[model samples]
Target chain A: MAIVAQTSRFSKIAWPVVAWIVGLIFFFPIFYMVMTSFKTDADAVNPEFLFSFTPTLENYANMTDNYDYWRFATNSIITSVFATLFALVVGVPCAYSMAFSPTRSTKDILMWMLSTKMLPAAAVLYPMTFLTKNVLGVFDTHFLVIVVLCLINLPIVVWMLFTYFKDIPKDIIEAGQMDGLNTWGEIKEILIPLAWGGIVSTALLTFIFCWNEAYWTVRLTTIDAATLSKLIEGNRAPEGLFFGRLSAVSTAAVGPIIVLGWFCQKQLVQGLTFGAVK
Target chain B: MANRTIPRILQTPAVILLLIWMLVPLSLTLFYSFIRYVLNSTVRPEWMTPSFSNWRGFGNYEFVLNSKDFWFAVKNSIFIVTSILTLTVVLGVLIAVLINRSFPGRGIVRVLLISPFFVMPAVNAVLWINMLLDPVLGLQGIAVNNINTLIGGLQDAPIVGWFFNMWPVFEPISFRATQTSSIAVIMMVTWQWTPFAVLIFMTSLQSEDQQQKEAAILDGASRWSQFRFLTLPHLGRPMAIVVMIQAIFHLSLYAEIEIVSRGNGNKNLPYLIGEFANNNIGAASATGIFAVILANIVAIFLLRMVGKTLME
Candidate 1:
């Protein structure tokens, strides 16, 4: 009995230490990037100043002169904001109907929506470019980026809303109906208020997805509508020359999203797995 | 009757929008795949325009099939996805179990661990390739140089000099090389995705039946046996979900491959298709179709699993 207790005591201390070590190791790159951003370009590469150097704000101050950081950042904000709002606008009602009034075919329809998401974006790259650039003449436009981002994220948005809506008991909606509320009134007055938290998280997750989206955003945009993703991709091979400024911009690009991600960590499993795991 | 009409009216816009989004570009891709189209062809200006007269039928598919890059991309795609899936699931299960119990600073650990998942893929790739993994000035190079210098200094010491002399000079690997680019991509993506798997598994772990575990302990079951019997079975569903979700995402990885080596040594299907789309429209479309077919194979199973839990 004493031996068992001793072993358990040993494990208790050993395991948490291991866990802390692992967490720090995983976070070291981001920590290093943030640390590097305060150094000058020369100090960033010089081994003599690797850990001990006079930190400066030059990288953040010169961010615009070096990379035109604000323009791409503004574009990222514009596209991701509009895309999240549009997805909520389109997704809310569809999820509302499916959750409340699901038909025999509703399950199949939901599955079909998810299946559309599975179709590789690479498969239609040229066609989308052809149609957008030639047929519609909207390539590299913010409108085009907004529409594409909205469409790519709509399925997940709807799926998340559906799962959230499913949890709100039918009696609440029925009671609202008995109050002589119209269909729109039931949704606006009853459903949205009851599901406000879910709706907000769904929007948050969708916005994060849009912000981090690299494939279509990079492919579809040039100078006019390029987001931070495109800006980073453009400077992919800096040849280690501008590590300080590059790290600063990169940190700026992802900093807010990482903070936002912490709040939605719980919702993420439901959002990404379509609630199948939980 | 009124009830049904209102719901249908509410759903029409979303349905139609998605239908158009899926069908239009895909059908265009299908049409282009059968024709010999090119962006700029001075010798055959007629072939530059996509029309039925330029129809190549299976010729484009045959051409893509015959290319060495297509096969390499397929093999590399499979290698990358499987490696990431394997590493993330294993690490995820272990980490989730580690932090599952109440710890002093568990919340901070989770936040730190999950931060990587939110880093944009472009930045993830660039941060890794240039700042973290670069052989000359990156952390890898610095660390390697420090170790070599330490060994050099220790070699001159009195008694332990012979042991230190036997150690060869440490060399930092250049991850941008043709042979190591894929490994670099796998490392970065695994870092980004393991947190995702951990979050999912931890959520599942919270719902695990503690009564069964206590019962096993009462039955004198060892820690290994208890984990094997109760926890592993409980985690099976989430593990499967993680694998399928990650498979769908990583199979079409583009930004990482592009930024890593610029498709120098690690071209996946999406990267290959991007290359073809530069001028060879027909081949690009055909390759795109192949990518769709591959994605669908995985999608079928995922949809099946998600569908089972839909109405429930």
Candidate 2:
């Protein structure tokens, strides 16, 4: 009794302080970036005004005039939305077949799909460029970004949906089939509703990945289809020239996704690590 | 149940898409690696076009193998990935344990910790390099310069003057330099990913057998011993998952390296491939093949570790 009481007392005082300190330390960089975004380029470089400055919305207000922020933001939305939708459309049927109808080769096919994710994007850079520009003539277009994003994320989407579908008992889906439902009807009426939470989380997670994707988005698109990743990449000032404007643009770029991430924090762990941890 | 047509039809779009996505570019890469191909050739214009007649089988591979930059990039890639994995796992375990128990601000702590993981890679690089790591204007510069000035002032204090004088002036490292840029990349990536590790481990920790832990406690297990025997084992699966997922992500890490170093002094395999792709199509393709091989070496271990569980 005494030992348990002593331990509880010790934990009560120690844990909260440690938790607060850790949280603040982790958040300091983002806080600093937001803080720096209010300072002029000159004040941003000066140590005297590090914490206190004449806070300005000039950077945020002038973002469109200075950097043309909306074009990239629109491109990001168009590509990420369509790409995620495409992945789900393709992934749903495949996951449905594998989940309901198990075979000896199902595991092998799943593993093979995952193996595609490991293929380095750099390995296919020149070939993709050649095909897009020289052959297909779709270079720097929203269609190309959408296609690339869909292909890259399809494996994870399939894996996620498979895991979600596997959790649903075979009886419910089997019963739906016996109730005079066709394949598409079974998916729409039975599977989709049962797995609504999983599907929503999967879509949200896929959107986040598509938005944060830097490599293909930056390399494949120059201006027309350039996403926020490209915007931030192109506007990376050498040193301290425009820290305020830079931070504002960056804040604008990642702000929505981070907020979206907060709402789906629970799903994030399961989605990202693919439930291997949980 | 043995109906093949419906299942095959269902999976066709996915399989065909991935097949083309994988095969088309890779086969082209193979062809380019064999032939003498260049985007430009002033003297021998024939070298500009990719053709079988211009076959230089294995020559590009040999050239890549012989190049010093290729080896450096390989070494640096391993160094950065290994370092980030090690740091994330270690720090992750500690933080996960720290926040595993109920606390007043646990929710807020989690939000703060996980924020870095969602920051776009490009923004992460820009924020770290320009705002935090810059020598003159970033936090490092501001902090170091302040410390130096304070020491300079204390140097005139009669008896303490001698002591302060003996201390040499401090210098802030320019992380953008050749040798240090890799370190910078490693630091920023570790910051972004450690939260991912912590989240996974924490989830796994929540599922740990509390009754078993209580039994150990009643059996007089010391704190260190309890951690070693109970907690560590519980975290094994999560650790493996963390390592494999991080391996896949960091193996092709590019935007951070590009934005931070631009291959000035620090180049990873992906960055090297990018550089080669700029003009030398043959060399880039060969290097791409090498990168593919390196990823496969890591992927084999990853598959063995997680593939079974994923199937289940």
Question: Local error of candidate 1 at B244, Å?
Answer: 0.7
lDDT of 2 by residue, B58-119 (tens): 99999999999999999999999999999999999999999988777788889998998899
In model 2, the clashing pairs are none
Candidate 2 residue runs with Cα over 4 Å from true position: A1-3, A6-11, B157-162
Runs of candidate 1 exceeding 4 Å displacement? A1-7
Among these predicted structures, which one has the highest TM-score? 1
Model 2 chain A: lowest-lDDT 10 consecutive positions = A1-10
Task: Considering only chain B, report the TM-score of model 2.
Answer: 0.96
Candidate 2: tens digits of C-alpha lDDT, residues A1-278: 52374376777898789888887888888889888878887888888998888998898999898889998899999999999999999999999998888777888888888889999999989999999999999999999999999999999899889989999998998798789888899899999999999999899999999999999999999889999999999976556888888988888888899888887877778776665667
